[model samples]
Target: MVSRTTEARTPPPPSLWHHRAFRLFWAADSVSQFGTYIGNTILPLVAATTLAATPFEMGLLSAAETAGYLLIGLPAGVWVSRVRQRRLMRHANTVRALLLCTVPVAWWYGLLTAPQMIVVALLCSVCAVLFDVAYQSHLPVLVGRDQLLEGNARLQSSQSLAQITGPGAGGTLVQLAGPAYPVLGTALGYLTAALLLRRIRDPDPPAPADSPRVPLLTEIREGLRYTARTRTLRAITACTATANFFNGVLSAVQVLFLTSTLALTDAAVGAVLGVLGMGGLVGAVCAHRVVRRLGQARAVWLVPLATFPSLLLVPLAGRGVLLAPALAGLFITGFGTVVYNVAQVSYRQVICPEAMLARVNATVRFLGFGALTLGALLGGGLGELVGIRPTLWIAAAGTSLAALWVVGSPLRGMRDFGCRAGGADRPWS
Candidate 1:
């Protein structure tokens, strides 16, 4: 009954489900994440249970998994910009799958060793560095900037879901069969993800033929300066880096604490971790609502402040009823951390220049993950010297303090972030 002009006004926004390319990307990313989570759980269990590794070896193994992020992160960003993101991601996954395949193969032949596992982890880390940079950079091209929040939210929710199911499945498999089966499953997952990625019909456009070439170091330095000059990015990076450092410490000792201190079985450990990961699922689902209620800027700093202090309970966990404290602490920490990640990642993506996005992301990750590697080593050494509980206490207390970086920074005063390329702080809407 209405006129055409009147009816056409203010049409509804397009849904991501209707976007075929995004659907493909989501499927690939989800599959890859699910496998990665399984690997994360099973690899550590292999080192601890199958190999009977010491505390320092556990820490060393943990550090190896993330070492590539610190070692090759910066250069990977520049490389990602030069290639077709989809192809790169596919290749990276394929390489990772092959590397992971070696683990179970060696184990079957009765040739598996701790050093070989560490080597596989290290090589996979390099591939992960490349794949991650390509993945994050490819999103804007696959879906428009307007759909970023929804796209990111959906992706994060899937990742959280994987965090819950992956560990449980891996642990259950390890208990029922052995570590080799889960390791094989992880390899298959990566191969499947690679195949899915190859099916993306709409791939990233080729670079311009006339685009000016620059030296690699020059490009790297430019990204560094850009991030350093941006007040919001700098503050966010500092907080994230600090948190990762302590998180590394926590991760290095978490399994040890659960298996040794509490004397939980492998299956029980996975179940506990899976239960704790439910918090991330809840947080990812509620992230948009939280941002709407609290404003994005407030959500970033305020959520961490509210939830991170709960980690103090982790060191207090023991047998029987005492385990409740650790469970509560991990759940609360996961919730806050996921919410903060969704908000901050969307903000950075919105504001960064399209050409510079990969570099900026890499720069942030380099610092954050570098700290993680150091923290892992520290956690291992401290667990041996002082004790597991004391290390946990130190890690928890340090993580709680990380929020202070943003609390006093310029971001505290802003409601949301502006979309300008260089450090401009204004309300987005």
Candidate 2:
């Protein structure tokens, strides 16, 4: 039998997009993604502006949405292992679509209340968590190992394109048709996603009957242990988690900083953010080339370093030419984030075992998303105490620190995802 290292070195099969099933899935995901972006922009504005929610109340809404990631991530992973991934994704999107519709319905009936909106947000968030975990787990099987990075780049590019138009369109729709109606659009998007998911052919074979079924706790521990044992995975996880923590903090304060500190209108803020989407699109398109030239290890290091230039503009918030600097900074930040994500995700997908994909994904997300929640809390409280500019400065400092996670790790030297010497047969080929 061929050694794992030899197998790893061999090229994987051709791309999955040539298959009709994957093409449909891709189309559906692209269309629905636009809708998700619309909802993302409209939801918080509805809570704060329409409901007259306090900062603390708004923070609670954010927390409620993210908290599900912490609560259900591990369990969802374990549960996903026993079911068909495509079916679970279809159901998840369906439920999300249905639940999102309730927001507009509540408003139509004059029954919209803060507590009810919070509940809707929480439920919708839970569905999002489920769909994301299932979707990520399914990708490796759908596309072979060699094309994983390209596949992800295509997905990210779609999302970035959606972001370019989604927010401004969402804002206009909300202004014209009201906040509740935008959610209807989001609901329809989910329906489209579900329809697309249905057309994708299942790629993973059925689990072995003789495969051991471990205890839930043991299964979770095994997933974590596997991640810990892998040098590349450990570095990727650390880098992603740290980056997310700081990025979350910045996200929490961005709108407030733009509007209050920089003296920009809401429209201006939205326009600037919409423009930043282009940077993400550029990064996604260039990621493959960057990885090819720099190698995976160097790409990870380089992406985060791109973010540092943006942080320098934080202190220039109130200067005469502030708008130009701020817009430029956000664009660069968006670019860095997408590049970093592509490197980290592609590496994770290649190294992880097929069986543990969902569990490992859930575990990583649980920790990273939990950090996001904490970061938001920290940003909000710090912003209140020291003002938005200072809060932003601190958040930037934290984000800069994320680069350290991989600087000295073994991941810094990794050239690719091939198996180690003397290991089992390479799975990618």
lDDT, candidates in the order shown: 0.86, 0.72
Would you list the clashing residue pairs of candidate 1? Answer: none
Error of 1 at 249 (Å): 0.4
**Candidate 2 lDDT for residue 199:** 69
Model 1 segments more than 4 A misplaced: 1-12, 419-429
Q: Candidate 2: where are CA atoms >4 Å away?
A: 1-17, 202-209, 262-266, 312-315, 318-321, 419-429
Candidate 2 vs. true structure, TM-score: 0.89
Query: Clash number for model 1?
Result: 0
lDDT of 1 by residue, 126-203 (tens): 898898888888898888888788888888888888888888887888889887888888888999998888888884
Q: What's the residue-level lDDT of 407 in candidate 2?
A: 69
